[model samples]
Target: MKKTQSCPPPVRRAALYIRVSTEEQAKKGYSIPAQREDLEEYARTNGYAVAGVFVDEGKSARKRYTARSAFMEMLEKVKAGEIDVILFIKLDRWFRNIADYYEVQKILDAHNVAWKTTQEHYDTETTNGRLYINIRLSVAQDESDRDSDRIKFVFQNKVSRGEAIFGNPPLGLKVEDKHIVPDPETAPLVRELFRHYESHRSISRAVREVGEQFGRILWLDGTRRMLANPLYKGVYRDNLTYCEPLIPPEEFDRVQELLKERSIRHNQTGRIYLFSGLLVCSECGRKMAGRYATTKRKAHNWEYHLYRCPTAMQYHRCPHRKEVNEEKLEAWLLEHIQEELNAYQMQWEASASAPVRPKVDKAAILRKLEKLKQLYIDDYITLEEYQTDYQKYRGKLDAEQPKPQRPDFDRLRTCLNAEFQTGYTAMSPIQRRDFWHSIIKEIRLNTENSPQILFRV
Candidate 1:
């Protein structure tokens, strides 16, 4: 009698995965209901029990694998041996990128978890099937890239013609017949913004005053944007009038110059920091935010100020654990800054007699324009090519022309020295903040090295 061999039991548990990119949400056959119905029928016929169902809606597969919340949860369950196989509608539905597919394939292989598509014949059980899946993924990724490029080209052409392709105009403007126009109610607020900023020459003060009058807390950034934005002058990013004017162009230009003159460095916040947004963790490169702590002791209660990174505060997962003692750090910074400033002042005195160089690179641009003309004269290019190249160089030359420089060093040095002479800590918080902003460009902190204070050149 011949010995009979018993067959191994078939795998029964399965995890169903369905995904729909934002662009495909309206398409037929990509609907969640259709996918669920097809996948369930396939699972029933294959003698596999539905262990779990994962769906990622309006999510792009082009993003990192970990970004898909449902997919990640399914992967975790697969690794734990709760599911024997993963079933999807198609390989492209799983991933368009080949690199991401392989990374996931390696994980599935290690855990002995097989993956298959209900609609496609490619299987992970054989070598040829795996190769076929890779080829299909490569084609999918190429198509995705081409689609992205087409969308970008269309957007750029629309913007070049000064057409508002995007929906909704920013705060003070409204879309009227596909054109950007000022909102009657909000337009007055925008005009008031410029007038208030021009008078005060302070972003924080303007925000506070305007916010109080309007019965809302106006943001500092919004006020600054209103002052600097060319939209108030009826212009867009390309510096041409694409919308109706709110403030006169002359008034807008004057406000910009005034803003530059009043900039106490880039420090716009009313919140005072002794190190002035300079403290950063060397290990993680995150800024160390200033914080105060109170600890109760047996003898006496203690109050301490500290500068700590997001990692130490449980906001980030970085490994750097060091916290800066605010009092000690501030003392060190003030002393070092004073010494650096004295040396910088001496260097400035030495260079006072030196000749000033032209700020704009006019000569270089003019030379390029001459060379471009020679190319056209020598018939090296067609009339259309010459005209296109000529316009490109001309635009560069126009941009290279000199503009006014601000926060005049002469004025800054005079103001800073007068304030410093009165004693560093003696000045009011705002005055001290302004003084530091004028002199110190940045301050970097490290647990291993001394605090590094970079002064304005």
Candidate 2:
């Protein structure tokens, strides 16, 4: 027989997964590049082909796999049969969550995939190895939990000592030597905002006037938060006196009373907004809130129900300042109901026939927003650029997505019939409100005071 030529074994493809949480990087000096180099060397020494490297920087191994984009992508590649095995530096680097590890391991098992840690020896093929892996996972998770408890204790101690926490100080204050001190530039504006709100007792008016006077962009929610914040009264958490008072305690107390009183009055109002939660502002993609406009005509007060963009009125960031009269909108809807229904049916059919679109990753977008805020605080980008990018990302967050349920077309048709019109007209204000809410999803109001109705369908 002729001598058989020797053939080398096929090289297995390996995917390297690396992760370093912020705390780990700071405390343990865990480096991604170093891990990558070591993993590549391990692969080379094992006679394996390095298929890909996935790194999740500033991400904890305990986080959900979905939240770790790189890890999720690696799983996708494994599912595609591109990866024979996954390699990490240590067991802790692979997972700090036992449940999450098993959840991912199920997928790996189904795909006949395996994972190995270069610095640790634990194989799934043997009972002892599997038990050792479980013990390591438990230890890692316990360590993470303990680390969290310690950090919380430290923060609480700092707060009790009237020291600033490790984050950006609120607006109108700056961090100085681990203490919060007034920023001369914005402190005066904060004082003015409180004084204005105290005197006027109107958050919207105060925010608008203060923003205009100081050339600053003040949002309604932020302004309200500032007014109610105990920090302004030299108190933080339960510390009683955290810093120098921006607004006197008496003034702050009085403003709190005004805010509470206004809120009670608003809640107890007799007026009912027919489309309170069903109107959207076309310009800013924010909800259009209902308000009443009162005028004195012939010595008698006339109250008109209206819907307007609260974002524009309160934040002054949006340009859609025009208000839509509720009566006119109702009349317009009555006249165009048939046409709108037909158009909606066509659109619904078209959408049903079209291919499904991938979902937008809302959690990822929120994480990005937080990162952007941190970047702005670090002075890595200018205010204008930050504002522009912030708005762009916010718009994406506000964009409409597909709804799960279709509209009740049969009930809608019945409600629109001439015979049912009489019954609808006879319904009380509350009943009408309920009926409209049950059938209409939203109505987009443009700057021209026109309404674009979107039915529940």
Candidate 3:
């Protein structure tokens, strides 16, 4: 027992992590070479055997470990117990997001691995040291948020001016002198696409025709978007562009009218339900959709069409007991609508004899144009807000300026009255559904009880 006791050598294995973002490559002391040298010297001074050197170049610390390959590989080695400690150049070089830092740090703590920064000396074994690191992480996170906001504000300011934030313009245009200008070569093709859509009033047919003739593959969505784009008419987001117009404004307006009418026709379905997209479950606040179930009665097949909460039917999230028959729902809605129509008719009759107010054609185009200029002058709103409002008002002005072909009010009134008088029996299911959609916003159904219906009018 008097002999000298021999103790095992201390574990000195360490993994060094270094990160440098794209913008930090040229910054002082943040280059890959500088970070490597500093980490190597720190390891040597501390008597640590460098097990591995993980460097994430052109990668932001704001990103998680999963997004950084080098960082993830380093974590794997730490988990394997190949490294006793992890060393980095600085706190920000380690992590910017506190949540991600805590998540990875939890794993490291479980593996009994210690982490330290060469520049910032702190004992990872102590509570006060961790508190100090957390405070620094909070500062880094706040700085990142502020930097993000500043970048956004600059981008928005540029966009508000209707100047090209990005160098590339749309297919038919090019960025010239920091503004969008029509490209002579592609502009003609854009016009031809719009003309094709206008003639056929079918996006698929237009795409097919263009693809066949031009020897270029054209998609239905691309053709549709080209037809609807206002840039062809020398306007973008309500602001007149510096580019030359590809198509006349009147032609664009006519195309829009055709598109709107076509869209309405597109939604017309043969099998129409009175309450689709209007039904909601009261229990789970989920949309109730049409469901079909079959039963056998003495060798004959019987089918039941019902509305059920999708959450309950698919996920068993709520009680699966709530359901309503389609026929019963339609009957209840028809009865309710009849009462509303009667009240509406009475109100119309009472107001019929009142003096008719002279309709004024509000020159909204001129008014909105002036208001837009005034908004810029007064600085009442940001340039982005002003531009958004200007575009909206200009659209409204254009739509309103064109006086509608006056119809005989008495005849129109008579037709509406006839439709109202016809009631549910005389109308098609599609027509009834459309009528309900126009007036009723939603219908909430509870388990085996009367539904709560909300009407807009």
Best model per TM-score: 1
What's the lDDT for candidate 2? 0.81
117-137, model 1: which lDDT tens digit per residue?
Answer: 898888666799778877888
Tell me the lDDT of model 3 at 55. 90
Q: How close to the true structure is residue 338 of candidate 1, measured as C-alpha lDDT?
A: 54
Clashes of each: 0, 0, 0
- Top candidate when judged by lDDT against the true structure: 2
Ranking by lDDT: 2, 3, 1
- Candidate 1 shows a clash count of 0
Candidate 1 local accuracy as lDDT?
A: 0.72
Task: Report the lDDT tens digits of candidate 3 across residue range 224-295.
Answer: 787887877877653455346778877787678757645222334344556767787888887777766779
How does each model score on lDDT? 0.72, 0.81, 0.73
* Residue pairs in clash, model 1: none
How far out, in Å, is residue 434 in model 1? 7.6
Clash pairs (backbone) in predicted model 3: none
lDDT (C-alpha) at residue 349 in model 2: 78
